[model samples]
Target: MRAVRLSVVTAAATAAALAAVTGCTEKSDASGGDDRVVKVTATDSKCEVSKTKFPAGHIQIDVENKGSKVTEVYLLFPDDRIVTERENIGPGTKQKVTAEVKEGDYRIACKPGMKGKGIRQDVTATGSGKVAKRDPRLDAAVASYREYAQEQADETLPKAKVFAQAVKDGDIEAAKKAYADSRIGWERTEPVAESFGDIDPKVDLREDGLEEGQDLEKDWTGWHRLERSLWQDKKLTDRDSELADQLITDLTDWQKRVGKAEITPTSMANGAKELLDEVATGKVTGEEERYSHTDLVDFKANVEGAEKSYELLKPVASENDAALTKELDTQFAALNTLLDKYREDKTSYVFTSYDKVGKADRKELSDAVNALAEPLSKLAAAVVK
Candidate 1:
């Protein structure tokens, strides 16, 4: 539960370094002329819309939250893939989202309180519109993120191997350090890792998912399980190293799959939003890394991944809306400053002693993360526009 001091020098240097690395332009918020705007009214538990059918193309939904609680609306594919989503729309505030859809059945989800399953309505697009031309800028952006995803996966394998070896050699101190180092690359490419069947769960599943009747002895597997052994129990046995071996094996396969993985502009944006959500929901609460208390590592990695996603799409997004790009860049720098406060070394942040950390310090980080999430959530629709 050690706390690392935030030096004024580090903060100034990080801000100065990243400011030059990412560039942005200035622009205004403009609506597309081709958008078929639909009016959507969201209540506490229901979503009412003007129509459920449209021609296949880009359609805009002007959503007004008239409920007591905050609400979010999502356009989802039949396979449950989210097309586009808007979050943190407070009561009485109107938010607009434009989704590029094809001829198919989809679900319109309006989530009240911004959690759990929302009320759903089936929406269909029948007639085919003229094929929209692909933007070369967005295509290049997708290619960039795809390459980054591969780089992250490749970076993870050797670290996993080192972690496994440390555990096998029964060096608890070395294993503890290796454990945090191992998670960085995984956290960066977590969304893509999730696409590789059950490998993600098998490699990174937390102990909280233990079945109704199962205990740690039964279902607890992957990184957290090993974490509990090393930090809580303060021991690494032969059985623990066996789990580490399996982790390396799984990641090796994931690396190959990531190389062939299909990454589009939509996926990149969704991945960025999801990464921030990971911090807000799990890491901020200290539920993730419950044993090691190294949630900062995951938080920093999530921000890194999200920023990389924005960087990939910046080319096209900046072309259409530079204001949003500039806002995101500023927010990212702010969040990075907040995270760098706990720098343990060149590549790691010391674990936050959750029990020892003050409420004000915790809230400061949480507020900074939410601030960044506000701009990140709009990245997809912004780029697509």
Candidate 2:
């Protein structure tokens, strides 16, 4: 697999200059003097040209953001001089930038959102000019995505180990509290739950917590019982030794799962889509409001999922079916852009008054997320086909 690089959108001044020079064509009365126009569209970290050929002299770049995020487009010269930069073209929107060129070989680099991969194309300055195929944004996005995942994984493991040790050391009360707190990390990683499926059933305490002949609550609340046991000094008796051993076994299994698992792009995309759907349906309930941490955790999970999806899909973009690839590219870009706003809004909550963020704020967030559904659905449909 090709190594992915972290994507940080470089300033216009930092990009390469156009190198290839071409002869000017005689102006014809029928068409406007040899001015060439190129339309560059970015979707799912890939760039495509509506037309391959145009006249060279003054060039106009029309950028269409068909993806789910904002994107940056750059026209570069051979000398690494940036001809022009068009930044923050929002989802489903379009923007134009013009540059005068003597013509030669120039590169067009488009990055979908600040953190996304970049798409690059090499164009030749000919009689007019022709758009060539190149994709650097995809590489950038994938690289950034992998980098983000690795960081999260690194942070999560040591914390999990600390909590696990607390449990083994008979610091039951501390272990219970840590377990509850740890849910924030685990829930963000629900898609990877299978990796931790070996959680020791003995530690679950679900069966022992039940009252004689009583029915279990629909919600998974066994953690609460474990909490009580820790504080109440209700140590397992000799007869319960078998269950304790089983619990230890389960925890060990969970550790292995966490160590070996790799998160896939498809899973991240699908999971985010589902969570967003729930939010749209208002199924998230008051728990989301009361437990602000839940919202924060969910937001992080969604971001991670979006990042991973871009990473996985970007590398395969060129090989995908044309229409499908184009559609996915567009959606991925839009989603990445939208996530930036979502992250900002979420961060502001730390200082902003939550009570003031009422219905309008929630609606705005929902609308931003809903904007992602169409493109994502199209991408999903294409994958199945």
What is residue 198's positional error in candidate 2, in angstroms? 7.2
Query: What are the per-residue Cα lDDT tens digits for candidate 1 across 213-234?
Result: 5556654567888888899999
Per-residue lDDT value at 66 in model 1: 97
User: What is residue 130's positional error in candidate 2, in angstroms?
Assistant: 42
TM-score of 1: 0.73
TM-score of each: 0.73, 0.39
Residue-level lDDT tens digits of model 2 in 310-383: 44554453355466556655655664454455444644322222334467766655675566543453332222
Measured by TM-score, the strongest candidate is 1
Off by over 4 Å in 2: 1-154, 160-188, 192-252, 258-269, 282-293, 318-356, 381-385
Clashing pairs in 1: none
* Alpha-carbon lDDT, every model: 0.68, 0.45
